[model samples]
Target: MDLHYTDAQNAFRQEVRTWLAGNVPAKRLPSFDTEEGFEAHRAWERKLKEGNWGMVTWPKEYGGRGCDLIEWLIFEEEYFAANAPGRVSQNGIFLLGPTLMEYGTDAQKARYLPAMASGDEIWAQAWSEPGAGSDMAAIRTKAVREGDTYVINGQKIWSSRAVFADWCFGLFRTDPDSARHKGLSMILLPLNSPGVTIRPIAQLDGDPGFAEIFFDDVRVPSENLLGPEHGGWGVAMATAGFERGLMLRSPARFQRTAEKLLALYRENEDTASPATRAAVTQAWMDAQAYCYSTYMTASKLMNGGAVGPETSCNKVFWSELDRAMHRAALSLSGAAAELDAPWLDGYMFSLAGPIYAGANEIQRNIVAERVLGMPRG
Candidate 1:
């Protein structure tokens, strides 16, 4: 792989660095899981949109600067470096927006993409029903077609950001005769629909970072459907690819964490155990490896190659690396790590890295079965 950044890439990095230096909030916003914090994050997203920096890979008509994937990666590097407010609109901008771009109708694109870019309609994911957490094939939510609308009825649990989101997208069974991965359709619906109910679930810190959603014969316009009916399994997998493989966890995030880990180690090396120092060194190396892996993936995509099994490998690598990095930071922090600081917050959030996108066990299975060509039991 080419290790050198082109002159244009360097110039773009400087541009992003300069803009972020000027624009990032001086004080950190509250956690976006809270009501006030949610609005605060949305405002930050709007500020990013105004700067034409929200999801830079999006087309220009969608309020982006039409940057390529590498530029998006560079932007992410600068963003986390600035200690910018966390992306409250990520469920839309990172996960659903890419899916919509691939499978949405012209009208759907015009309707959702711009609002998503502007953070006017923040989105939550409505996957992981009571039965189908990792086994998406087990999803029981159904959306029955009724003329110009689909009447949806089911329960969705562990929906991230649902407590405050304006909309959601997920795979619902439209064909009663079908089960497992088959006969599913991807649908988008407003959170305030007449027959919908939302109950928030608190995180370790008591913030409602997730919610449970109940659909009681909720009706969404048939036009809201994305991709082919009964073919949503593929569409959802495509979305999963983006989630597990790309946007949900970016390399810059881990790189920043690694830098913090090194700084922590340097400050506490006198008292830190020998093992902790070794782990810190390993974390930095892993972060660099992840950054390179992601760069290779971006290069492939930029050159018209699809992200496949290797991205699953990337997911496993970075997620575990994030947890390890946080562990090292916590160890370096000694007793102070117990306090409510960035290290504590990051450590808590890192605990979920292996679970989000998809559970690491399942991802390892994918690596074994798909990448290594090992036979499945």
Candidate 2:
């Protein structure tokens, strides 16, 4: 893979850098977990759409620049460098958007992509249930077909962004007689529908970053079904690939964090021990490695290779790297770490990185069994 950027790519980087410099908020917006913060972030999404930076890799018909994955990486680097506001519609744009592009009907694309790009409607993931988190095939939510509509009845827990999101996409049991991964379907539904109840689930910071959703005979049109009926296992796996792979956690994010970590280490260099210095250096190296790996993956994808179980390896590496970097930052801060809100908050959030997007343990299993051709026993 070529490490050098072309003249056009350099120009694209300059364009992104210039736009972010002029448009990023001078002060950071509030945490998006709050109602006010949610709206504020939504407005930011609109601004990104106006700039045609909402999801650059998406086709132009969906409010994007029709850029490739490499350009998307460049945009992300400039965005995080500008310290731009977090994407409140990430659940839609990152996880669901790519899935829609791959599996959604033309009508579904026309109905959802524009609104999703503009943040007119925010989406939440409703995949995890009380009994099904990492083992998503164990889902029990039922969606009984009723002529032109589906009557959904079940519960989903730890649904990120559901408390204030306008819509959700999830897996449900379309055939009650079928067991495990079979007879399941993916469905999209409006959160405000009657019989749908959302109860906020507070994080350690006391913010409602997640929610428990109860569906009591909630009805949605048959058109809301994504992909083929009872064929959602494959569809959901595709979505999970996006979540665990490139879109959900871009390398630029970790690279930026690593930059901050090096800065933090410098601030304490006089007191830093050899071990601390080594840890900091290792973190920076890991970040660079991840960035290069991602570029390789993007290049392969551009050549028509598909994202597959190997993303599980990427998931485990980045999540652990994030946690390690944050932990180093906290250690450097010493007693003042708790008082440093940004680092503290980041550290807390990083703890969940290994768990979400499928647990690191499960990811390791995929890597061992699928990527390495190891036995499953």
Candidate 3:
């Protein structure tokens, strides 16, 4: 139950803080309102890569610092604090990286990991077909195996960043006979492959972060297969576990956000309404809980303990907390929370927190059944 960081960890935090102070550019924060903001984020990601601070937790063999998880957490804190940029390669870095580390061939790792680590190749997740959504086992995209290649043909909806990314990794039906979770295979495909088309899905915030991808006889090299054929379900679950769980946003990041919200609250003497006060207080408490939860998780990971359903709970908690905080901010701002409002855009964008990274409801189910030992429906 030790929640305190060691002296060495504090030093690591200072080091990250110093580097970010010098390197973080003075750019306006990104807005979900326009494509320009998204491009700015990508540019910032390139800057981070050039600075050699991207993917700090990955092994040095993959162009990372190979730092411990605590150091990674510290770095994330500083990154968010600097308001640097939202991760443009998050799906690739968080979901696919660990999966490749676990199941990819040496050549596959050599081919993809370095470029991904360096942010030279951004990636998107090609999961969640229109019919699939939460029931990922129901994905209908088919990949028929040909000699030395797999010709893929299907439409993937809600494929985040596919419109701008270079690669996508996901499950495809390699065996027509396979039903439910069986007969699926995890494959990596280049987004620029012939016959592939991407159409953006405009969100309420007016950003095209999600896109629909059509694979019309698109062919990928057979060498891109990860793990065993018909064994993609396991690989996908592992990838999702990392994606929806711990690797993307760490606790310190949440702590910094919460602190910012608290500062906002403190600066407003008009936020004296009982409800607003209570909401702000609750947000602060939730932020601390998120920090503690991440601390425990980082400790466990450092001790060689694997992340399981517990990370699902953390994801749900922190994401919902973020939404709550932003909601409170809107409430505090009252009439200024509408479109063209000062706080309107950010508050609206925060609304998507619960929906991304495996919707909060699904995370709750994972926590209830897999982590809490509750019986399934």
Best by lDDT: 2
Q: List the residue pairs that clash in candidate 2.
A: none
Candidate 3 has its poorest 10 consecutive residues by lDDT at: 29-38
* Reference-based TM-score of each model: 0.98, 0.99, 0.94
* Count of residue pairs whose backbone atoms collide, per candidate: 0, 0, 0
Model 1, 186-278: lDDT tens digits are 999999999999999999888999999999999999998999999999999899999988887788898888888888888887898999989
- Cα deviation of 51 in candidate 1 (Å)? 0.7
Candidate lDDT (C-alpha), each: 0.90, 0.93, 0.81
Q: Give me the runs in candidate 2 sitting further than 4 Å from their true place.
A: none
Error of 2 at 335 (Å): 1.1
The TM-score of candidate 3 is 0.94
Write the number of the candidate with greater TM-score, choosing between 1 and 3. 1
Using lDDT as the measure, what is the rank order of every candidate, best first? Answer: 2, 1, 3
Candidate 2 residue-wise lDDT, 147-208, digit = tens: 98999999999999999999999999999899999999999999999999999999988999
Best by TM-score: 2
**Tens digit of lDDT per residue, candidate 3, span 271-330?**
547777788889888887777677677788889898887778777787788778778777
